[model samples]
Every structure is written in structure tokens, then in C-alpha cells.
Target: MASNLTIGQRIAWYRRRRGLSQEVLAGLVGRTTDWLSKVENDRISLDRLSVIKSIANALDVSLGDLLAEPSLFEWSDDRGSHSIPALRAALTDYRQLSPMAVRIGQEEPPSSAGLASEIAEVWKAYQSSLYTKVVERLPVLLAEAHHAERFSHGDARHAALGVLGQVYHAAASILTKVGEADLAWIAAERGLAYAQESRSQVVTVSLLRSVTHALLANGRYDAAIQLTSDAAALLDDDLPKATPDLLSVYGTLFLAGSMAAARAEDRATTRAFLAEAQESATRLGTDANHAWTAFGPTNVAIHRVATAIELGDIQVAIDIGPKLDTSALPIERRVRHALAVAHALSLWNRTDEALATLLDAEKMAPEQVRYHYLGRQLVLSWIRRQKGKPSFQLTDLARRLRIV
Candidate 1:
């Protein structure tokens, strides 16, 4: 019986089958012969998905045939001597779970022997979570995926790349939540490059959208708009089906454009963009997939209210705000909560009620609340400046809302 071969041995086997020495193979693949020698000797590591595919193709063998070993044990100098066992154990724990359990645990299981299908499934689940913003569990999932990539061969390497791209995108998103926009952009760019290498158009679009969102959040709205336009142009003339999954992204981009117009105080442009978003929502039809249902009619209503508030159309904001559904919104989306508070204050001219709403939102998500609540604090200060004494109830609320 043939002994189980490590990835390095498989590469050596393929190289020998082609009747090419390490020097010749290295030249064909555009690498120094020493690099190929180290790979064959298991002295170096390979993680890039594209390189693995190139080797598999050159050897005229399926990736699965090249990576048939069920287990891989290896040494790595860069990760510290102890890191390999820890990583292997982690991968082992990951592989033991059923797919449903993996979902519940918020992790992607190590891919089974076949590569492409498994990676695609994991990518689908990851995309679904993005719409609902339940991505807190992504980092651990991604770390395991990186471990799996180290030993992948053939189609497995492609699968690993697909998984790595998802991991990068998820990390970028988490970084954005923690206020690290620069790192978020870098991660996003890396993910996009990998997705392109994978030849996955859907993943490419998703990464571009992430990049646009990060740019918009960082106040680089012009760049954000340009990126979105370029991505849209790259898509074929055919539009993707109006699934809620796709609509959430499409709707969010429209909302971002409206927000940009509002920031510029371009009332007409803002209204047009909001109208476009509402139209997109209407086109989505009423299919309620939890993953896609996040950006529903309520989101459109909130955008309208926000545009009105920004345009100084207080009456319009008041009229539309009460009709908007708040049930779908997570308590952590504090900017939306602030919009609710602003609308209520305008409608009743009741500082007390508005103060209460703001206080409640601050309690729910204090960190997120600060972004728009700072403006609310300024408004309260102005009201107090004009009045001989601040509303005592409002003052109490302000005390609670202050970060320090």
C-alpha cells in the first residue's frame, strides 16, 4: 500500500510524474528552484489558493487526488513550535460537528473531502448573516478556515480561498464596528483580490459593497459613490433576481447615496435617492427570508424621516415617522433610535418625550448611540441656552446620556 503523502510529497509526486526537476518546474511556475525545493521538502508553507491550483493543473491531477490524506501534521517555524498542535486540535474540533451544529456554534466547519461545494455553502451562510448584522461570531469561524487552508490541495485549495475571502470580508466588517476604518479597508481590499482570483462574481460584488460602506462611513462619500458605480457597471446588463438577500445590499447603497445628498444639503438630490430606494424595496416583492428581511419597508421609512430631518422639513418628518415600523430594528442600531427621538421632538414640541427616547436608546447601545446623539446633545444645550432654566426632566436625561 502507498503511504499517505503530505501536501509536499504530493507536489513532489506530481513534479516527478511530469519528468521535471524542481529547477524546471520552478521556472515554469515563475519561482526560484530553491522555493520549489523547500515546498517539496516540507521546509516551507503554501497558503495562497491560486498557487495550489497552478501546481495541480501543471501536474495534470485533480486537487482532491493531490490532497488525499485525511490528516496533516507539520511543523511551522513562523507560528512558534507550539502553534501547530493547537491549530490541528482546533481544526479537529471544528470537523467533528454537524452542519446545523456548526451554524448554531457560529463557525464554519472544515470542508469535507470535496472542496468547491462545501466552500460555496459556507459562503452562502456567511452572506446571510451579514444582512442581519449577526456577525460577532465570524472571527473564530475565519480563524479555523485559515487553519484548513494550510493543508488544502487541488479543488480544496480553491475552496479554502473562497472561505478565506469570506473571512477577510467579515473581519473588515468587525473592524468597522470597532472604529478601525483603515484596517477595515485593507481587509476588504484583500478579500476582493482573493474573490477575483476565485472567479466568483457574487463575492466580488459583496466585497465592493463592503468597501463602499466603509468609505461612506469614513466621510469619503465621493469615493464611495464612485466605487459603487464602477462595481455596478461591471455587473452584466442583466439585474440579479429581486431576492431579499440581494435587495438589502442594493437598498443600503441607495440609502447611503441619500445620506450623502442630505449631508450636502441637496434636498432635491436626497429626495430622488430616497425615492429610488423606495422603488427598489417595492421591486423586491414580499418574500420574508430572515436574512433578507432586514432592509424592509421600515428601513425606507426611516430613510425618508432622516432625509426630512436633514432638510429641515420638520412637519414632513413628523408625519412620516409615526407610520414607520420600529419592530424590525435591533436595539443596537442607535442612529435609527436617534432619528425616532428627533421626529418625536419635532412633532409634539415636547422636549421631555424626546429626551426619554434618547435616554432609552443610549441605554440600549451606548457606544453606537454616540454617533448621532452628540447632535441631540447640542440641540438640548441650545434649548437650555434660550430658556432661563433647562427642562429639569431633560437635564436629568442629559446626565444619563453623557458618556463620562
Candidate 2:
């Protein structure tokens, strides 16, 4: 956690996270290793704002991300990460004010279309692994959504609540990625509640899959699978009769269920869900971003790779891994697929190949892979399992992630 770290400690943390030695980081910022060590150990104070900005930029984090009290893995039952506390507090504050009273607090009123576009753009940023930017934008946007909700009763109200739900859902997704599964669930449930209020099947279904993934991440396999199954049962129609949006949602549901089943080693269930997802993909045509989910033929292929890994069938995963056309996917999904392949490679003791796979993922979205708990753990495990002095590639990966 960054809460109590001094500037120097923060620098050291970031440096280690990037797998940089004092010498390496010093070189990047054009300083001596001794000088960098002194700064990291708090021997010298970083008094200039410009210097601080430079350090943060070199680390490829925002000044706020550098200085903010980010809870890397600190957990609260209802709030997993630091972000949840802010969200919970903001939500509590909003609960006290009447909806009408909240409308007056908007910084400036925006047109419905304009506000909708803003929310959409926020989602785009989020799906691209721009978590820092998302965290920066969510507060104002959620508050504005509340304001809009208070003053409108028709389609505008649905639009506003939909945005609010989506914001919470995005929060859940990022939280889950950072290892705060509990907080992720809280955010997801809040999103699902708002989805219900908006009366949007698409939103609600999307949330169901999201929460399912969170549950699966936390090792609640049965609960995860059940959530998707129950959600599917709620839909009054089958895939063939469903709208494109509904089919998309169902496709994601089955894919998530397939993951959970694979984790449970229920091969039968896994293949069943996999088949169903492919069917939904067939119905929807190639990859389509319905319900904000990049569900389609390409995603289906990606999930097959993941399921193969989960089932401990590394060869199967290797065979399917090359068929992915992730260019059509959001960066987040692309990184996920790459990491899955990396994991499979690691299982086969293909250490260099695994590192290369992870590097490819980091190239796609550095922040997403670098700070992600699973990827970090994978690299650490790689370091531990190496039979001799680590390979340069392994050391480079570790140094880049700062696990060494």
C-alpha cells in the first residue's frame, strides 16, 4: 500500500514494480545510482514539483497515481481497494440528499446527448486499461448522473441511471483486476441495482456476467456459475429469438460460465457452456461490442484458450492460442488472452516463451499487466522455479515488474 510511503519509498516501490534496479532507473532518468538510492531511502527530499512530475512521468504513472494513497492489496470486507472507500463515501453522501437537491450541485448542466457521449467515452477509456483516467473521471460523472436522474423522468432518466450503473460496473471491473474481489462485488452489485432501476435487460445481464467473473476470481466457482445460469433463466427468450444485445449478453454469460466450470474441472459443463457461447457468437456474427462486452467469434476463440489452460490442457491451449484475432478486441481483453497463453507456457516450463508472451501483453497495456496481481504472481513464480541463475529475459521481466 502507498498510504504511508514517503516520496523516496514511493519511488522505490514504483521502481521495483517496474523491475528496475536503482542503476537502471537512474539511467532512464539520467542520474547516478547512488543518488537514486539516496532519494529512494529518503536521504534527500524531493522538494521540487517539477522533479516529482518528472519521476512520475518516467514511471509512466500520473502525478496523482504516484502520490495518491493507492491500496494495492489492502482489503476491507465491504471495500477492497482505496477506490471503494471514495465511492462508498460519495454514494453515502448522495443518499442523504434528495434527488432534486442533488441536481443543483452539477458543475455545469450538459445536454442529454453530450452527457451520454461523455459516459461512453469514459467506458472506452476504462475498456482500454486507462484506470487512472477512469478513477479521475468517475466522481464527477456519477454526480452528474445523479443530478440528471433527479430532474428527468423519461428516457433521460434511464440514460442517466444507465450511465451510473455502467460507471459502477467499470469500477468493479478495475477493482477485480487489482485483487480486491470483495470491493469489486460491492461495486458490481451497486451497478446491478442501478441496472434494474434503468429497466435495461442489457445492463442487468452485463452486470451478471461481470459479477460472475468477480466471484470466479475469488474462487467462488459454484456461485459464479450459478449467477450466470440464473441470469440466463431470467431471460424469457432463447438465443435464436433474442435481440442482438440479448444474444451478446448470453454469449458472455456462457463464456464466463465456461471459465468457472473449467476451474471446477467440470469438463462436461465447460464444454457445454463453450458450445453455447459459440452458438451465440454465430447468431450475432463476428465480434460485436454488444452490452459493452466484446463478445463475438474472436472472443470465443480467446476464451477457448483460457478454458484450455484452466483445464490443465496446455497443448490444447497452445494449439488454439495462435488463432486469436485480438485486433478487434479492447486492449483489456487482448491482455487477458495473452496472459492466459503466458500462464499455459509457464505450465509447460517454457519460461522464455512465457516471458515473451507477458511482454507482448505489457506492450499492449503496460499499466494493466504491470500492476495486475496475477501477472505479478506469475512472474514471481517463474523466478522461483528457474533451475539456475535466471535467464536475461527472466531477469528483465522481473526487473520490469520489480518483483526481484
Candidate 3:
């Protein structure tokens, strides 16, 4: 039942369910009844994300609901979705309460160093765009990190707590990617609690970034921007003695804020945030992935592209996005930048080039392209615009993404 409807049809369904008149819905989205009538009848296409987001907001539905994302999640090949339940269980596991509940194992928890190494492996998998692998690894890793935090002592206990915070950060990151922003928020809040308990400023700042991301994903743009700004301000006093990891996280915070500002259409604020990030990038002096941030000069540039796209500066996105050398970045960042470029190209009406860019990205990270909203939206838009049957390549990609 979910597979056959276009986005317009879905919108109509939701609008009817809410008992909204076309006049009321159109007014809510700042459009006329005639325009919305066309939209509901599939005579118009929602080519811009901002517009679609506005409609989704007006209809009181998530962007994913409008896009029919549940069907994609239910598809057999979406391995990331398959692990979400287990990961949720791990997050809620009662054994983390220690003496209050039955312990699951007799063996002592891994040492701080061992836990760090294991957590780093999960980050590595995530950076490589191996979402399924990361999701699969997180549940047990989460349980073990909790055990380590509970059993270890003194400095070892603090270190274990920091590792536990990082484990939750990873959980939040993966959940956000899979469109489970609410779950990501829960993971991030839990991580921040552990981070504060560990008394590590760096871990706290890093987890704040995760929290900011979750906020942005949930469309709390102003809250996300404020969080980034507040977090960035806290670090400024320590800037004189800041390490590379600290600088990386600091810069990435601004990068995230810049995105939030752009989404809010606050051009001046967006530019200001980008400049702040650029300063950090310049201080870092190279393309580095300190603290798994992938934050550096190159990443700064990538965010510029992303922000430009959000602000409807398609020319700016196309100008810098396609020309940048992101080879030094992680596969996840590289593929993400590629999708940004593809989005810009599609908006510029360079459909062939957009398809080529997406094809190239699919080769690099099939799961990333298939699961990413931009890629899926672009494919759907192109298919809808085709006067006749779409090319076999386009159809195949759509089928694989389960969005046809």
C-alpha cells in the first residue's frame, strides 16, 4: 500500500487524515489553494527540500513520512534497520544498573586501552560508510562499555566512562544517519551524562556535537545553532592551549551551526558561522580527522558547499563542491560531499551529470547513496520528470534504493 503512491499522494493522504481543507493547508505553507490543488493532484513536483520541509511541517509529519521512508526501512537489504531494535535494547539494558540487576557475564570488563581500541574500530567502520557493519558492532560494544564503566576503578574508571560516552556517540551518529533522530537524541543525552560524569571537557564537547546533530535532524534548527554557539564559546577561553582534537571538534561545531543557520535562511548568521569554522580550520593547518571529526580545511570547504545548498545558492554549491579534493577525508564524508554535488547539479538542471555523480558515489558507497535522502529525492525527481520511461540505469538505481 505504501509503495505505489507519489509524494503528492502521501501528502494528500496525510492532509485528509488531519481533516485539513486545501485552503488551510495551502495557507499554512504560504501557498494558494490552487497551487496546493495542483500539488495534491501530482501536477506539481516538490523539487526543493526547503519547500518540502515547509509542507511537512505544516502537515505535522516528519520529512521521512512525506517521503515514504518506512518502506525503504522495511526492505530486506536495509541491514542498518535490522540492527536498530538490538541497539535500542542495548541502550535500555537493565544490567547497566549493576547491583540493582542481574549481571550478564562473569568475566571482568576490558581495560580502558582495550575498550578505546574497540571503540575506534567502530568509528573506523562508520567513517568507511559501512553503516550495516557499524550498526551490527554497536550493541555488544555498548553493553561492554557500560560494563567497563561500572567495574573499572579510579583513573581506569574515568577512562572507561569516557569510552562509554564515545560508544553512545557512535550509537547516536548511526541512528541519525538511519533517520531515527529521536532515538539519536536519547543516545546523545545519555552520552552527555556519562561525559560529564567522566569529567572530560573534550568528551563533553564532542558529545555536544552529537547532540547538535540530533537536534538539527529533528528540525530544531534554532536550538541546534544555539547549542553549537554555546559549546563553541566555552572552548574559546582554552583556545590558546587547544590540542588538534579540541580544535577539530570546535571547528566542526561551527560547521554544524552553519548548516542550521542555512536551513533557517539566516544568511548573515550562516556566513558568520562558516567564518568561525574557517578560522579553526586555518589553525589546524591541514586535512585531518582528529577526534573522528574529519574537520580541517577540506571539511570546512565541504560545509560551505552544504550550507550554500541549504541557502539555495545552487551556483555556489556547484562551483566549489565539484572542484574540491576530498580524497583526504573519510569515505563517509567523501560520499556525502559527492551527494551534495549531485544535489546541486540536479537543481542546476544538469541531470546527466547528476546521475553520473550519483553513480560514482554508489560505486564508492552503495549503502550511503541508497539510504541518503538527497540521493533518493534526486532519483525520484528525475523519474517523475521523465516524459516517458526513465533510462534503465535510473530505474535500476531507484529499485535498489526501494523508492520506485
- TM-score of each candidate structure, all chains considered together: 0.55, 0.75, 0.93
Please list the C-alpha lDDT of all candidates, in the order they appear.
0.55, 0.74, 0.85
- List CA RMSD, all candidates: 21.4, 13.2, 2.5
Clashing pairs in 3: none
Tens-digit per-residue lDDT, 1-404, candidate 2: 53435567778888899887888888877889998898876555443334565677688865444443333433346543555456556555645256446534455555557777887887798779876666656666667666666667788788767767777777777767765666677778778888888888787788888889778655667787788778878885655578888899889999999988887777898898899899889888888887778899999899888888777777998888855679888998899898888877777768678788898898888778766755765666666555688878768876676556
Sorting all predicted structures by TM-score, with the top scorer first, yields 3, 2, 1
Q: Cα RMSD for candidate 1?
A: 21.4
Write model 3 residue lDDT over 139-243, tens digit each, in one string: 988888887887878988889989999999999998888777778899999999899889888798899989998887777788988998888888778998899
Q: Give each model's clash number.
A: 1, 6, 0
Per-residue lDDT for 59 in model 3? 88
Tens-digit lDDT track for model 1 on 102-132? Answer: 3334544477343334434444443332211
Model 1 vs. true fold: TM: 0.55
